[model samples]
Target: MNYWILSIEAIMNTFSIIESKSDIRFKMSLDSTSERGNILDEQSINAGDKILVFIDKPVGEIRYMLEVTGVDHTHLVLHKSYETGYGLTMRKMQQVDEETYNLLESNNHRQLHQISEASFNTLFSHMFEDFSNRYEVKTEQPVIHETKEDYVAPEKNPQDEHLPHNWIVFGAPGTGKSYQIDQQRKTYFGSNYERVTFHPNFSYGQFVGAYKPRPMKEDKSKITYDLVAGPLLRTVTKAMNHPERNYVLIIEEINRANTAAVFGDIFQLLDRNEDGKSEYNIVASEEVKEYIESQTDADLVNYEIHLPSNLYIWATMNTSDQGVFPLDSAFKRRFDFEFISINASEEKIGDIDITIKGIGTMKWNHFRRTLNDYLLQHVRNIKEDKLIGPFFIKKTDLEASDKHFQKVFQNKLLMYLAEDILKTDKTKLFKYPSFSQIVTAYIEDEENVFSDAFTEALAEQE
Candidate 1:
């Protein structure tokens, strides 16, 4: 395993954010998908590497250390924060911990620097520590259901929360339905879930398996067609091969694609038996059977695909998008659904405020609630679905600065209102008749860019 030190500079508030939220983010010169001449792939840093976090300020020192659970472009998310970490002085580390000192000295002012694994192990005295990737085997432990109603599991992790066999979380845009799924799944299970987003062109062949052309191993000029597995098939194969464990399949934007066409005959397998196994089996074609055989070492069984009881499929549906396929009653019946209100994810927005130097400053939540209220009362034919959620803009963007907030507000919210929500009657929502006027008002007007009624509503609320 590789080790690295991530130096956090600039912005004092982010340290508390990272520590309180137990998630770290760093701006990198190169993205996760970027490639260079020196490293493997585009980024040398990967998911399994250990990271030593250093706070850059009056006294530069390494504080907490954590494992990189994921590498999302410029962000490095961990399973959880290192929790309680003692601050270590560079001088002490240099004398006592030479491995860490070497990396710190050679970092050369770079944000990220590789360190020796020996230095990492010397910092901690845990026995189960090794490079075996503990996150893999422990990710999302599935609770296997038995035919007996009272069948109890012998060994259960206390943190493991039982999940629904077939479930869907639906909500308006930015309502944190996906965030809810992600956070809850990580808490109940390990941080080892795979998610797939459906789009207009997403097809069954892409979701499941299909025969595709490939170059012959011995002859570059010759071609052959073989069955290739998709995300669902790969996940299902893994779950089926290891039935003792539970698995989860997360589908985002379930209605973006033609659900009926995408699921095809596999829809029959959505019905589950009492034990969570699929009530019916999908008849596997010869190529599918061959592919399954080649991919897995499962014991002898018929050439059929079935959903095991331990396999759970959870999906998210956005209720506020256009040009999206509708889920039929028959398809919808297979899963239980939960709806998230716009206010459900309000805490994420916090009490941060937006301020303009020459104009006025308003609490972020106050602005959101006031705007939503005004929209509901004043905007003709505008539904709650069209109203902005608590998380329409992230907390960071809200606190970025007056200019940045103004630009973001003008570019995103105002544009959304003019084009999408208030297109029926622009005068009902925005102060300006034209889009450019609306943007210009946000940039220059001191009274605010929203309709007079919205502005008055904000005043009354404040």
Candidate 2:
């Protein structure tokens, strides 16, 4: 069977959805199209062909494999207006884990990828075995549930059918919290989205909307202020106007600013109803309500602000960062939290070798794993967040030579340890006349480097 990659913005964006007009992405037309039609004409995908469904935002991740049921000339939902394009009917067949999906780097470059039989068996078989026991598991069970006569079944990815509307991904620094959040919004099909980084002085007006001065077009000297929309306001405006499409609002380092103060009265809209709409609409100022209404397609009712179901709000937090605003029970309870593990990207260090002058060489992954354990074992009342992650020291630092690696150790690694971790009580861990003596001695005179504690830490295995 032929293996192909199919790019989609949403799981159910096919002409299969009733009253759906989003047909451009799923079409396989030849005469009018340029790149996409050329690909489809060459492939000539059949009913038995395999399709690896991928999200369309270039996140380089695949969730499921589906089989092409058939090629439908007419729209799947029975629309007569669209006839030039042909849509494929697909059914989810197999699934893969994120780690397994990340193994191949080729898919990162393109939305479409086709593999030969030999390439599929060599590469895909191993990855599929990591999650599911077999490369292909045949099951004919239908996933649809009948409800009403006019109800139609919408296709969703096997694993991620439902995602939390308000979610936060948290982890220690370098553990890829923001990276995780960035990848997830694509699965939600966030074509229209906004990303804002929070700082100490960020305010409600900046998060929502504010009146800003603008030079008049008629005269350069004259100026009048207008209500300018912020990230949240712009995203909400798009979501309200186009209810069919999904929108996202990303808050990077959310706790850097006071969420309670930044969100203001908008916090009341966090509680969502069964349909994913905000349970309670927060009262808005008359000016603010009028501004939002003018930007939306929906009729104005109570003149209040309510989060649309199509909008998803996500944030990332660094647990290691100091002086961050704390969230109360009420604020924290409103969202689901996902913690990224320190060992998540351990394999990314690969087989990079760092050799100390007086001591034998150790692998990058092995060194960090040993050092992290030593911090927890030897130090008193130490937190996991304080320990360095897999990406704490870049691989390039050790790729050069032993002398260059020693310089990085003395500067970045040792400096972080002295100021943040050990503080004034580093005498027991590091060996030197003073911390300043590290530059003069380059481990040439002794069997072990920095100190006995560090030497012992490096000796650890697994």
Candidate 3:
């Protein structure tokens, strides 16, 4: 039986056809379909006839071997190999007589078609423009580069689908744990975060919203409730106004305070599921209410509270505190705990220096080599906790005219690490001088070609 060309959709009606090739050599009209019209460009085409199929949805040209099972004035039945035949499938087809077949078969058809001059040129202009567009279109792909400066914010790619209500960051004093908190606050909370360092005697009322008693007439005149909104309540109020922003409440040295005692009723807010804005009242059982009421002459029945969605907490701790108790398992599970490891100087020292220096020089690549050399020798020491943060040497605040930078290194950075570096026995470990002394040498090391004039200015300031 002669092969016929049929669409895959024609498989409902059974008929077999020769294998069809998919490569199209001729320009095919892509607008036609079996429902609209199935007539090929040429009429009366026989089996083994090289024919083009226009595929419209994706708009592409495909070639197939055509086999005619039957024909009529309005339609023709053809078969293709990949699909089974549809018997007497209706389609508009053009007849390809022997002479017309010869004209298409010979390569000279191009020369003859080209002679159609304006008509052929117009057709090709549109075809080429379409083909060029399709060929030129580009697919998007993600690029990942391995570099020291590749810092991606956690919120930009948070582990959870939603941001955490409370977060705690803990590590050694100089491990840059607080740095992450500051950055996250800047990123998520922008200007809304309120940070406070918790101390041993810090009160629950100080952390949570509390009524501050104002001085009354003769100390017994009247009691006025001064609502002092703590970091938690302040963040809650800030987040309520700025729902788009994630308002962060940062507690530095969280272990310094009695977490359970300090949090008190606000501890209920730490439940991640509560999310701070629930309207329901948590009814305390009568027995518990009666017990609490008996102990404190206060009505302790139902507690009406609303949780805010925008409030988040970040706490930083120093693990060296033996006096501080471990966080309760219930409280710990509600938070995602990420332990910020101490610096691996090899990984951080040189890179941080280069980053700071590049900022100083305004050249992105400047100081890379110098920074790398400094860290290559110091990474092991830092990993062993023998070295303080290397960022101390690369202080960029010296260049800044703002009081903020001056205060950041002093208030935050120095308090955490200056003593650590000064205390390190570098002579016993690396046969080197003290960190500050070496830094002094570097500032005075004008003979060094890489050292900038600004170095001398900073050294003078020291």
Candidate 4:
């Protein structure tokens, strides 16, 4: 049976009603009648598919599991309300398997929690207490036999679906580039990806493979060094063995380390052909060759290995990060860079009260928007990179008292301003003579006083 993924937006109104009433029926609008022409149509939704229901922001979680029982032009009905909450703008839906569902559930329903056909079948089989009603069982089988003559699976668009083998997501800090990669990892690799963060001291041995000391089994006092493969080598080996499935290796803050030094000879493998396979299949060093042979059962007589076409290497870079190791043109040419821009969505946090020490209770979203706007207009040389993302301050952070706000400002906002924004011209940026004075004014003054101070500073500059 074919599987699909579907999403639905659950607004507050619908979510509250469903939670209290236990109603499983909802309306799902189709683009046109032709869109629902046949069960086999590209846009046609069918019964027995699994659903991962998502609620609106502030309520951001998969609240329900639903099995589609029926679908019509105006509405879709579920056989059982596995979970609850439906309200708002749009919901993402997808077909998944029992394995995938279990994996998703284990991850706190955080990532890919879409329903699978296998899960639906299991849900359907045990739904009834007794099997005496044979006729009822026969009638309820969700086999889709109808097919339209014009129905065809849509052609894959390279720009939309296909990701380059080596790509870098570059953006201002907190622009959700890593979040995007995390979501894509769930979509493509499921739970089978390795993530590593690069730092100033990261080395080739730590990345590719390294010989580490371990105590000998025979003698407690004696120790032996063993070659252990790092994230890159392990992921590469896994990809080589399972060529049919895609494997991903995510390098977070790739520019934080010396790119050339961290990669060493493995850098050559970044050069790929049109088909995405490594162009120069280089032989391994004797140490690495022997290590590979010893570690795996697969024969490697030639001592040569190439990065498989299915192995995806993804990295993230912050535009404003300081002391980034530069990548040469040859290394840079191998990657496709996608820039993430600042999001201007006016999403606010709800159901929580956050009161700063000197400031009265205020909406977290309003405070963020106000601060960002003030910084942009008043602070000299401030850019989008210096602004904070909407999700930077989470719900949990607001649960605490003034301490949370203080910690956030000192660690995140003030640090950014000091290191990046006010480094060159502190006097031009703020009314205060020093960074400490500006921070003191921000903390000690009332909310309105602080805002007015910023405005007065801007006015003085004008």
Candidate 5:
């Protein structure tokens, strides 16, 4: 029997081993004829090869470390107990040494992950503290996956070519404005996209580039300041370098921040030519110019920076947020605005039951439609803008408990009504003395929150 030993330089090959969240035990059958078994056979996995164990989603994390002990081509089968836990039937088995198995089992699968050995040691030291308490783990091994294929980029949409370089997707709360951008991003840019949410405090320094402090590598006590490019700048630099590929910069809740202030002179770049390039390019600030010159190709640093046609700028805005900074007509005209309307139609997610504790078991779709209809008709000053979208309440949220429902209602819906929608309306539509009274009535099922006037209106529509 030929045993293959891995050299120190062969540690670069990383492999992900799949395991269920309920079970972290490492058990696999190595068959010489099978695809997975072939890799183990080719690599000559021995008792000490290091392998990463990944827990599949719902518990998405690299949860355990495993070492290969004995790799058998035939007659070695996985125990039925371990096979049932992982949802895999093993024809051959690779056993781990007793001590390695015991150490992993005792830890209950605490996550310890790092890209390299040095980083792993640093992290492991802080978490475990005892340097002497090291297990005799194995060397690098080949990944168990059947095949590794490079990703093929999706075809660009012809419609996207005609669309404006800058776009603002505005909608009511939960109207899937950001979701649309995310979908478009995956279609166009694949994984090459940067997303940033614009809060009130978001500034040009944070949006573009800023001189920030960095700890000195030689001495942890010493520090150095470097020009760290923000998401927009970093994406722009990446897009400029890779002109062949499309890049997306997603500005989530764009209206949340002071648009004029956050954008500063860069707002001029929003104006695009007929060909989708920036109509007027702007000179980068001294700090930004210096950073760009050092980081990117010479062509970018030679002249004023322009927003590339291939760089798609997508932004989202919620009309319900009162605190959002208003965009002037000039700024608004720079980008194409796509308005997303509230959709209250039911969505079916299999046969899953969504039962609220006090509200009883009900179809989520029916509940959203009926509630939205009631809000639009009977709630004072409540229009489609103030109405809830179908997706606002997820099936998982509904299944959790009434507490989740109450939290969403009190924090989002009721607060919006009390603070914005019905603030100035003298007519108390629900006939509740206070907002709390309205919430109480709805929670306790003491009163029909909607008036009898809406009953006829609802029947007329039906």
Candidate 6:
């Protein structure tokens, strides 16, 4: 709370205050996300300032407003809300009247535009702090059954080719690592990114390509080498076809399988050449070679396998998962590892809850605080790796349609917290109170428990 107060002060200093209201005239648009034409007078706003909008008529709703964070001749980008963080304002453009622009410049509007870089950073520091406190719960959105096709890099030059070939992302559960990859597949993979999971049984032949038995018209079945391209093969082939387009091959649960067994000799191609040509060798295991020789007439009989320089590999693994070990030194050298933690902003979580619950009557903040505190008291002694995921606070979980929230809390969540505390025998919790009862009782008692710590603890046990 103290930090939020300080951030507001820093934000105030980022742009010089517009003291003379009469000197400048500005145009405002509130319903930009929708087709509703809700515009307001420029005189109602101050340059480089923040405001909380209150809808007074038609339908009641509240919106946060930010001044034009940046401006160009065509569009003046405005900050949508504090939820977007202070530095990331929405980009939009409006036709500006020359007379109004001249009047604004002649007045103190010019002074407001002359904000220092240091002041801008100070404002962001505060914004980040506010964002952190509000969003403690983080969950990955469901993967849509859609794929994006296009490969232009928005923030990078067309000719730039310095992107890394191998990268690793580490994060707690529900941190959007998978969701981010799925949603932005086109941006990273040049419009044709492919993904596959790596498991203990996965091998080089299975990942690169494999053949299986196909039944014929007769009773007997004949095995034909089906050169069905795996995700890795598809990604490389796509990259070869479009040099200008980037291509990504995402390996989910990379640590689950032995990298050496799966990648085999192609691991050398992990390094990228400046000209964007991947160097690969025809080094396959004896079994793979024998299989290929047996199918001489197969389409994959004579194939050139080389990872293109434009091909990128993005791998994800949970460090806390069981049987997970550090990567081999050779494997480690090929990747840039990044750690993604759970850092959600409260304002963003609040908005998400509103969308999920499809109701405005519930106080989400209260629910979040209560749920988090319950976990804290019960799970204080657990390891950080075993901490409860914050995403269960979503409004959808509380709704009658899904018992996901209840199952997670009573089963998986309780198991994690049980490692820390036990009113009776901890093992009893795992089997006691059947799944249906657990959910029903939790839903009935979540909002009705007494304030007494003992009473609340007792209620949780049921």
Using TM-score, give the best candidate's number: 1
lDDT of 4: 0.58
* TM-scores vs. true structure, each candidate: 0.63, 0.60, 0.39, 0.58, 0.59, 0.48
The C-alpha RMSD of each candidate to the native structure, in angstroms, is 18.3, 21.8, 30.0, 24.9, 20.5, 25.9
Task: Report the lDDT tens digits of candidate 4 across residue range 1-462.
Answer: 344333333223332222211335766444333323212232445676655454434343344445667666567675434321112111121132335333433432112223356654443332221111212222121212114643232233222467798989977665677888887776667645778999765556568765443446677455444555678888877766666667778999999877876777778899988777899877785666765666556666787878888888999987577767777888899899988765533243445555644445666555665666777876867667667665566545666667776787566765666657767666543555566776777767633324356545434443
Q: List model 6 lDDT by residue over 168-195, tens digit each.
A: 8767654555655555454444445667
Models ranked on lDDT: 1, 2, 4, 5, 6, 3
* Candidate 3 lDDT: 0.42
Query: Model 4, residue 436: displacement in angstroms?
Result: 2.4
For candidate 2, write residues 164-217 as lDDT tens digits: 778889876667777677666555553456688997655555677643334466
Candidate numbers, best TM-score first, in rank order = 1, 2, 5, 4, 6, 3
Q: In model 1, which regions exceed 4 Å deviation?
A: 1-162, 219-223, 299-302, 356-359, 444-447
Error of 4 at 231 (Å): 1.0
**Residue-by-residue lDDT tens digits, candidate 3, 73-112:** 3344544322111111111111212232232334211111
Which is better, 4 or 5, measured by TM-score?
Answer: 5
**Per-candidate local distance difference test:** 0.64, 0.59, 0.42, 0.58, 0.53, 0.44
Candidate closer to the true structure by TM-score (higher is better), 2 or 3? 2
- Model 1, position 270: C-alpha lDDT score: 97
Q: TM-score of predicted model 6?
A: 0.48
Stretches > 4 Å off in candidate 3: 1-161, 213-225, 240-245, 274-302, 321-325, 344-387, 392-462
Model 6 per-residue lDDT at 151 = 29
Off by over 4 Å in 6: 1-162, 215-223, 274-305, 344-347, 351-383, 389-408, 419-462
Question: Once superposed on the true structure, which residue ranges of model 5 sit more than 4 Å away at CA?
Answer: 1-152, 155-161, 299-303, 344-367, 370-383, 399-411, 424-431, 441-462
RMSD of 5: 20.5
